[model samples]
Target: MNAPIIIGAGVAGLAAALAAAPRPVRLLTAGTLDAGAASLWAQGGIAAAIGADDSIDLHIADTLAAGDGLCDAAAVSRIITGGPLVIDSLRAHGVRFDAGLGLEAAHARRRISHVKDATGHAVTTALAAAVRAAPHVTIIEHARAVALDVAENRVRGLWAETAGGLVHLPAAAVLIATGGVGALWRHTSTPPGADGTGLALAARAGAVLRDLEFVQFHPTGLDSGATPMPLISEAVRGEGAILTDETGHRFTDELAPRDEVARAIVRHLAEGHRVRLDATHLGAGFAARFPTIDAACRAAGIDPARQPIPVRPVAHYHMGGIAVDARGRASVDGLYAAGEAACTGLHGANRLASNSLLEAFVTGTDAGTALAGEPDAAATTAPAAPPRRI
Candidate 1:
């Protein structure tokens, strides 16, 4: 059987490769690992239902409530119910989640998986390693997909530009695991290359894209001198950091939903106020617990241990993308999506804390099973490259 073609080697694509490996798969990525994808910069943990007090129903309800009015019930059910399985899968792949933090607020119990504060990095590292070990999986680094190769209302393959030359790779199936459109905004935590490529590709291929306007803005992005806002992981605040303004007056509560917190931070900025990350409350232990945030604060000339680190709201994740069903199948035949690129309605208008990685794991495996169930067929070659346009 011909290998399935996967685009964008971020968490979603890597997860898909690991699940479908040894079964014929070619993974294409635009840049070196950890440089362009938001997954690498993610510092929080993964949401799950493994906590003794938390129920799958509670997590689903939080996710649906946070998503606002656009969440899909069945999709929410699938992800919420699948959370424990996803965590187990990660552990099997060598991920070590934090212990003894029973379900956080908004949760009935503790169900988040973590490896210190670097859960996303650990999960991506493990998934990438697993894929690398799979001989059936082909890795094409520095290969940027220009567009989806579709013909007669069906997906055939993709057109990509590689370091060598323009190459047309055919495949029995295509998975668009490329991430969000965070680049559209001026200040974003998304990889610069993350500009709406996935959306453009899916839309060009005649797929239905939804909720493009539901972009999520994360509060507490370091306001120091980072060109693209560097995020101060929510887990820090969850661990008791405070949000304040320059005068040292508390502005927004740390526990507020992300959208509200982001909007509030933006409003403060427009009012000429400087937002601050009050890690003084967390003490020297702050740097010990969240090394990334500590390093970022120090690099920006702020000693978070002694004073507050300046912060602002920045575009983080997209709450919408190529619409898909419960099994991660796109509306188009022979095309599937997982992770950030595919919106299965688990994250409504806003995502609950640490749920992004969780959704990726659950849907990636589902997409793999669904893809493997397809009939064997010959792959169609990609067409000639077209002129690039924004």
Candidate 2:
């Protein structure tokens, strides 16, 4: 019997593979395991209610507040409650986070667990290593899933375009972990291949997409003319950096919600003012705390420790996607999704900083565990009506 097919190699995909355990799994990626995955570029850490002053209720309330009243209450409760377990799972896999939690924007308490400033890179690297060593997981790099194979309202498998040629692979179930659609926009902080291919594939397979318009634009993307602009970590602002216009006058509050901050930056640019993130007040501690941002700024010929970094709003995340249940089951049978590719309604219209990683871990685990329990080649069944689009 064929193994379950999992597409994309981001944090969610790798987590799904590991969660499947003894069940054989085929992990597919458009590029090398870490190359095109946006999870590798995340500078902010994962949000978990692990602080002495933090509680699950506070985390859930913060998430719902950031989501702008469109979040799924039950879904928010589930993922936020599972956060500490996710952290422990990562640590058991050899991913080490900073000794204590750091705060990010919109959170009422300090609850972000990190690895310096490059938390995503550290987590993905460790998870990828575990996936590589798993006996039941087979990784297929440079394989882009072009379309799903659906028959009689059920997903049969998928066709992937590989370097060798196009190939059709069979599966008992298919899980889409393809990151997000940020790359579809002009200015973004995502990899080039994050063009909503997974959403398209799911839609083609009769999966319902929800909240397609709720794209989250990150404020303070470095305006260095890079294809996918480098992001200035929000943690920088949480640590006391301020936003100033070209005239050196402080404007919008740096710690506002992402959507508000992004729109304010856009407004500033419309008024012919160049918005800058002034982190010079952070002094030398800036480099020690945010080595990734420091290195990126230096690469763009700007020293963040000495000068303010020019910034702009850029597409960063999709708060909507292929609609799914808390267990990550899509509308179609034998089809599932997790991570940024799947809209479990945990994020709603806007995403809280660092919650993306949390959702990815929780939903990916649920999807993989559910698939592992299914029969290897069970007959497909028609799904009920798809979820309503917001």
lDDT of each: 0.78, 0.89
TM-score leader: 2
lDDT of 2 by residue, 1-390 (tens): 468999978899999999999999999998977688999998889999998889999999999999999999999999999999999999999998988788888999989999988999999999999999999999999888877777777777777778988767778899999999999899999999899999988987888999999999999899999978999989998888999987899989888789999998999899999999999988898899999899999999999999999999999999889999978999999899999999998988999999999998899899999889867765444233212210
State model 2's lDDT. 0.89
TM-score, per-candidate, Cα-based: 0.94, 0.96
Model 1: lDDT to the true structure: 0.78
Candidate 1 per-residue lDDT over residues 304-372, each given as its tens digit: 889888888888998799998877788788788888888888888888888888888788878876776
Off by over 4 Å in 2: 378-390
Clashes of each: 7, 0
